[model samples]
Target: MNIIIWNCRGVLKPSFKKRVGDLVQNHNPAILVVMETRVGGDKAREITNLLPFDGAIHTNTIGYAGGLWVLWNTDRVEIALLSKTEQEIHTEVKVRLTNLSWILSAVYASPRNAERQVLWENLMSVADLHNMPWVIAGDFNEPLLSEDKFGGRAVSVNRSLLFKECLDKCNMLDIGFAGPRFTWSNRREVQALIQERIDRFFVNPSWCVMYPNAKITHLTRCHSDHCPVLLEMQPRIQNGRSRPFRF
Candidate 1:
């Protein structure tokens, strides 16, 4: 089944709404995961209603940070929000065609290294508990290597070795670079030269093996500094295709 993951920045803006509508019409994924929603309570509900499917939202108290959302086509999938903590939100959904359960962890890690460590630990714990086919996709806010950045002195403190190690321990595979290579930009002259693959998609081995045809799709940039990332997957087979009987 097709699944898309994007750090929408925030869906409250008019530009974002138009972009989202165009995206939904163009790709029509079975599942959609959004990070940094920046909307809470009633505003969150309003955003959900605007999407093409049924969804749930997790919002933070401080307004513009830590908010996440998952939207899925109600007709073909069943979704349940598994858990949510201060840093991340976990969701599990069953695809009707495959009968295989899929778990999605949409995250927004704080830029500070200390806070990120705590968040990484919490995410790892949840993954261990579930122990199923899953994907962790969002703006990690940390780059894996110096190659991931454009023109800045590789800040040793900024790299997320612990986070990368945690994924390795969990046996998840990074989906690798999809398009443009960079998801975030500084937008300033010299700083604009700074770009990195801070956003990524990691999947459990089981899911990758099961859906061998799955891929990540990079879409055009909207109003946000980050561009949207989509996961396109082939429909799961329930039974072997039948050959036509020749007359």
Candidate 2:
């Protein structure tokens, strides 16, 4: 089934809810992960209920900075929460009609470089917790390669190296995306402009064996600096169900 991960900026704007609904209608994702929601648990619950999903789990906002929520259509997929933190939501998802099951984690790493090191370590720790096929996704706030960014100041080689080291430690490979090469922008002009591919998915070797054709798409965005990311498994899906995804 298709799964979506996005850094919505925040859902407090007047048009945000409708935009979210439109995305849901268009994509029909089995599970939707939203980051940087900037809302508390109560508000998150209210917002997720407006979508087509039947189940919701969220992490509360710290002041007005960070928040995360995972919404899922329970009828098609079953999810059991393994853990939750300010940085991520870890769960095991199983498809009802088949022996298709895997560990799916959604994470929003810290904007601060120092904190991101810890976040990276935490992600590796999660990898250690399970031997199942694992797919971890979201806005990591760091690019793996210098070419993964454009229109920005020179990419930090050290930062990217640290992130790469983290991935190597976990033995995960990035499941590259289609559509836009850059998923985020500074919305500035000329010398101040910046764009980067910071949101993505990384999967373990087991995942490749399970769904060899899995891919992610950098989707269109209407109200945020970051484009929403969609991960579709096995049929090399482009957008929505037209390209079906199995387990």
lDDT of each: 0.72, 0.83
What's the TM-score of each model vs. the native?
0.87, 0.92
> Where does candidate 2 have its weakest 10-residue lDDT segment?
238-247
Residue-wise C-alpha lDDT for candidate 1, range 1-247, written one tens digit per residue: 6666677777777787777777788887877777777777787887788778775656463546767777778788888887776557788878887788878887777777788888788777876687788888878888876677887768464345686777776567765434687888776698447887777777887887777666665666678787788776663433332321111
Reference-based TM-score, model 1: 0.87
Which lDDT value does model 2 have at 192?
86
Q: How many backbone clashes does candidate 2 have?
A: 0
Off by over 4 Å in 1: 61-63, 155-158, 190-192, 235-247
Pairs of residues at least 3 apart in sequence or in different chains that clash in candidate 1 = none
What tens digits encode model 2's per-residue C-alpha lDDT throughout 26-108? 87788989899999767778877777789988987778988888888989899999998888889999988676999988888
Best by lDDT: 2
